[model samples]
Target: MHRLFLCEKPSQAKDIAKVLGANRRGDGCWLGSDVTVTWCIGHLLETAPPDAYDPRYKRWVLADLPIVPEHWKMRVKAKTASQFKAVKRLLGEARELVIATDADREGEMIARELVEHCRYRGPIQRLWLSALDDTSIRKALAALKPGAETFSLYHSALGRSRADWLIGMNMSRLFTLLGRQSGYQGVLPVGRVQTPTLRLVVDRDRSIADFVPVAYWAIEVALLADGSSFNAQWRVPEDACDEQGRCLNPALAQQAAAAIGNAASARVVKLRTERMGEAPPLPFDLGTLQEVCSKKLGLGAQETLDIAQALYETHKLITYPRSDCGYLPLSQHGEAPAILQALGRGDPGLAELLPHLDAQRRSRAWNDGKVSAHHGIIPTAAALSLDRLVGKQRAVYALIRARYLAQFLPNHEYDRSQADFTCAGQALRAVGKVIVESGWRRALPEALTPGKGRETQPAQPLPALREGQDCAVAGVTLKDLWTQPPKPFTEGDLIKAMKNVAKLVDDPRLKQKLKDTTGIGTEATRAGIIQGLLDRGYLRKQGKALAATPAAFSLIDAVPRAIADPGTTAIWEQALDMVQSGEMSLEEFVGKQSAWMSKQVQRCVSLRISISAPASPAAAAPWKKKRKTAPRKASASKGSAAGKRAAKPTSRT
Candidate 1:
């Protein structure tokens, strides 16, 4: 009997077919003597809608909820139903099956659900491979594990899916009902991940709204020699300033400024010079890529993610798209040379630096221990093919290519020098620096340009002199500056915040726990989670920044404080990690989540939402109850005004 292969999507199926020598492609499948290949469009089957259980669930009504099913039913999605039926028939005839979905929780769910829904009783094996290359696929096909071995992963995926449904469906309906009861027509949306993300926006807005700027003063001293001038900004001693830097009293800054102003000349007290080495940056993960793209190129999180996905899936120019770790495995060291060679061939600028590439001496960013699930984003052997992409895709691919080429170069080194002078017994200082080596920065030299208010001063190496070097006081200028409030969250800033949620917590142990965990969500899901908020109208993008909607902020306020805080999600992530590692039971982790979902559902039901009524005619109707009218009789007078009335609310449960 032939082995049947199930792939996640049609593109993957085609790729695998090419690699497996199943080149004879049929309508919905490819067949070879050794294997038969078929594909799924992400998910061919999903949990049935509430209306599927009973006709009464066709309309929205609070009385029909908490629509809990005894055993959740599954149905084929209409668009893909025919293809699914074909796969189901193939599965029935095959003696063995191979699950060849992507290597992740959701991917595993897709495969498992297909097997269950299709009642595939044949012996099954899993095709787990990271890359879609010929070698990777061959090796995976050679050592497929029994389907039973992945049961735990399936259970975890199931728990996640059920929990999301329980919370999202019930809470959304509850809020919608509450809104309608209050004369609002807008949909009140809610989700497990989206709500907490929305809270981040709302909290930041609150902080910005309540921010008050206070006046502060700083003193600067200028020293001159040979018509060259350097200035140093002043800072109050730690003991002189209050805890909040109110300066203990404003008089202190006034006195210090006056003392410096009264001096005729200052004596050179001390001078120090230091050399510093700046290491190359860690490799780019999805979050870091999204962040840098947003800051540098003004790309949104979703935009960056899509680009990365295309670079991985379409261009084959990067490794797996969704990765949290910014480090590569030690085993991946040997492959660097080939990747660099490929990059050099694609870009002439990079080809010039090929001589300096060091494959043997590994950077700290390439450690194996730091990597989990997937390694840092790196260029594959695929050359840059800009002709294959347009718009955002091209921009994102360019970023990944630039970052990957930067890793193999040398470190950026600079020398820092300080000059000191004293006037009227007061000490003054100035700092100057020069680049020692452009290093990796040579790849992206424009990044080193100083911003506004920053002046490039000559190195000014001091002539060998003792402490008594006489220096003339240059013309002094007082510069006034006001304190600024914190900047708003851009997509990049938000990704950084999510990855480093530990910094937001006060407790050291708790902070460490969050750090040890991956923080709120995996790199793969974070962008999608953020987009879900935008799509649901819980958050809005104003230019490049994210701000919470009123309904979003209100929902966050109404929910339990812990649920709204990232700290809580951080803690849950820590627990989830423990479960994955077998330190904690899956049952325990899921039990806690279920309880949390129930509580959130109750909270949503109890909370009040005040929203303006929707202007659309379809949204203005009141809740209605079904009548004992026959469909034949109702249709006979369909054109009549009475017959055109909307259907009554149905019982989903």
Candidate 2:
């Protein structure tokens, strides 16, 4: 009577196998006398194709669409049939089974689908593993949960999969057919998530294209105080300043600068110093890690995830890389000192931090309830040599490790000094920061750099100052400025927008729903969703920013407003959460989606579409080469109203 373990992938399978002492290799699994360990290469079975529902679906036509399967079927993935057979055999033999997949909704789907497909009726237990280190693995094994505990997660993931398939299959066919009627041959791929993401880019491009740059001016004053000189800016009074606080009248700015420059002395009106303390940043969640890597290391979103996966799966240096939470469980707090000691021993650069590592100080990151399925990504005790990682891998590891070390350090303390002065009856202000205690910043020297973009408050340390003290206004200059348009979406910026989608929404209920949900996609799938857009030509690289192509604009315009709204994902997620909580049934959710999809298809099928009409091109980078255009010709017959494309939808990237 053997107990069997089923894991999501081979790397994960091997990790669990080592803990179970199932070292001997069999057909497609590891075997020991008392137990067997096996894995599916991420779902050996997938939902059957539309053709499986009916043969007529093999051809793409409008009438044949709205293909809803009555009895959903899953077939073994052709490439990994052998592994499926091996797992099936193991399931048949075991008296009891353990599900050892990644501890998330998708992972639950991967394992549970197989169990139902294999017709297994054994007592099922769950091994929820967040980290692969020996200590974490053993701790999880000692307290295995019953399969019923996570069964709702499987339903949630299954609901998402089926919904995506319905939208992808039906909508792609319907739109592609519509485009063809207008003589456009390119396939118009639409997705529940990708469409909204596409809309985000499309909207941003429109905002940029329509932007009218407004010119303004400001006055700069250089002052000398107590043997130290610093520059400050003249503050425009209420009557002189524009809505954005820019001096709209250039002459007024010039007059102010001239008056201030002519003044020989100035008097300090007020001085205030406030002490501020900042805790270390929370550790890396997959989204935050992807954002930082995209900005600092110049890595793509998928590239960052790939590097992180390698660190987790191949090197066993860090915990699971796909976690969404940035908080760690309080239970893991005791393990910090050992990890810190090992880190110092691994790199001489970290040796200086060894003396300051205070394990007793608990930051806001250590909360038991805040953590879900998995905690934040962190270094595992198995990590020894940083030398094993190179390039992006090494860079990401360092970032993850740095956040862990910072939690033990004291709060970063600083003195913020603001000096207000009067020069020739003009108000001028200057602000400076003085480090009171380096604290966590000692581990991160780069944090001290001024003008790091996000922190627009320039750190100009000032010398000792006194209220009502006299100072000389050495010089004054007038500077011209223009209100800049929004920049294109960088992957980092996109990730942030995705996480904070709640801000974009207006409907209070939907906004609240989005707050409860992660952005448009899950952390595990966001990178893939982005890569898929690039692959399909819906989104193209205009240098570093992702811009929706003309094709993308047309597809988004062609779709119903309900489908393109970012809030759609929130509503869907709300229902899925209901399924997870048993407030809604999976069958009920899918049925509702089918009804909604059917309404959308019927409402849209009769509409005429003409893609030959031009679309406003996304704003171009300065370095982009100008494209050569063909002589203007008459558009397709029964085509768009004019050669000029419609004004794009309003955008904010």
Candidate 3:
């Protein structure tokens, strides 16, 4: 009798099969002499929908507002049921079973669900590994743990799932009913993560809408000399006044600009030079990778994530893709040399820096304690063969590979100089930077264009000078500028905001509490969370920026404050982490979450929602009647084909 092994996805199953000598492949399972490997397309089992428990729920009704179940039931998804059955048969016949899903909460839940649904009573073991590399897989197989060892993780996953269901089901129904009553046609979708994310978009929109710009002025000075001319900016002293002493007078700026214009030439008053060094950026986590890709390449959060996933699961050039921690384990120290060597093979620039790759220099960011289930995303020893990757995967892989190679290079060193000149009565200053050492920036494509403003500028170098030194001014001209409002959030900026939510809040204690909590949703879930808001029509994309819909704003206004606040999610995350760390009981956490959901549901039901009716008579009908109109078929034309391709796959745990 063979030991049956379960993996998360086919790519992972293939890697595990190759390592376990399970070469005889079937539809979804691989047969070996001692072990048979099988895989699931994410989730094979899921919480049963309301309709599954009661026929009345087939048609959503306001009367059936809160469909709370005594015990949530699990159902095998119809699409993957046949594959699940085959796995169940194998498990029943096998002498032992091994779980080899991804090393995370969802992975643990997948194994638990398979065991629960199949009723497999055989001895069970778990194959826990961070990456799909042969060495990692082999080691994991050698020391597989008893399935019970991860019961806590399974419990936590179950708690999260149940909590989401309770809140999602109750609130979704409550809002949908209320929305219809108020004459809204669109589905008022809600979720644990989706609602909070929508609230963020709504809050941001509110801020931008209510923003009041104030008039401010700055004085500009121009100097003329050789072909090179430079400009200087200064603010009028607060004590300075117009003809009248009142500081509020706008004419004071004109007076200052005129006074500076009258000066013949500026004399050197002070000069300062400073040397600075900038370290290479830390390794990419999923959120960081998404942010950078979105900002630099105009990829959506989901698009970037999908590309990163392919790079990890298909290309095998990166570690686990959906990682939150930006740190690697100490054991991975020896692997850096091989990674650098592989990177140098594909990128010509990296070849020059191979000798400088520090095998002994351990980064504090690469600490094992900082890493939880998965390490930071880094390029594997796999050579970059662009031919193997199609569209977005190629782009994402290039980013990961480039970032990994960059870390192995030296720091950027530069000299910055600032000179203050007194021209007649006005003071003017000139700033310049000179690169002393290109360092890691040498690998950057835009490093040479210092002060260009298109890309990040290299540090400036200052010349040595004294107040008495007479340096010829190149030239100068007045430059006009306008004060602009805060820019809207791109997908990248939004991801960064979500990751650093603590910084956005003004309260120090709350900020610290948020820090103590999980920074944001797990990497595996963040993109989906963003997508959910979009699907719900709570958030819309406007030229790569997220803008809140009117309905979303109103919903946030109607909802309880706790539901809209990131701090609440932060607190729950903290408690969940405590459960995971064995610091708090799973029962305690679940009990509290269940109670909170109950309270939130009650609050949602009691809250008054006043939706403005559409101007058209047909559209202005009560929500109940409007909801009967079939939901618009999600058009394949609206989104990329990749999104459509993903829809066919079975949901994963």
Q: After superposition, which runs of candidate 2 have C-alpha atoms over 4 Å from their true positions?
A: 447-457, 612-653
* Full ranking by lDDT: 2, 3, 1
What root-mean-square deviation over C-alphas does model 3 reach?
7.9
Q: How does model 1 score by TM-score? A: 0.84
User: For every candidate structure, what is the RMSD over all alpha carbons to the true structure, in angstroms?
Assistant: 10.6, 6.1, 7.9
Distance from true position, residue 575, model 3, in Å? 1.9
Per-residue alpha-carbon lDDT of candidate 2 for residues 1-653, written as tens digits (9 for 90 to 100): 47998888898888888988889999999988799889989889999999988887888988786999999999999999999999998899999999998899999999999999999998999998878877888999998999999999999999999999998889878987888898876567779888888788777776766666677887778889877898788889889888867898977888888889889978889999999888888889999998887777778889999999888888888999998899998989988878877787778877767788798889999999899878999998876777777877888898898888888999889898889999888999888889999888776658421123533456889889899998888887787776676676767667777767788888998787678787788889888888877655566665566666666677778998888887887678778888988999999999999999999999999988866333212111112443554323222211111111222232221
How many backbone clashes are present in model 2? 2
Clashing pairs in 2: 203-651, 204-651
In angstroms, give how far residue 90 of model 2 lies from its true place. Answer: 1.0
Model 1 poorest 10 in a row by lDDT = 633-642
Please list the residue runs of candidate 3 whose C-alpha ends up more than 4 Å from where it truly belongs after superposition.
51-67, 121-123, 139-149, 224-229, 238-250, 347-349, 425-427, 447-464, 470-480, 612-653
Models 1 onward score TM values of 0.84, 0.92, 0.86
Query: Can you rank all candidates by TM-score, best first?
Result: 2, 3, 1
lDDT minimum window of 10 residues, candidate 2: 637-646
Across 1-653, the per-residue lDDT of candidate 3 in tens digits comes to 56888888988999989987889977669888888899888899889999988998988776676666766789988999888887778778888888888888889999888888888788878887766667656767788888888767887787778778877777777876787777766455566766777667666665555544434455555554443455555434547733422234456656656666665566778878778777776678899889888877889899888877777787677888888877888878787777676777766655566776675666555677787777788877766656667677776777776666666667778777777877546556667778888766655556221232532223333345567755453333333333334555677787877777787777788887887566556678888888756655556676787766555667777667787777777677777777777888867776787788776776567566865322223222324433434433232222222222332323211
Clashes of each: 5, 2, 19
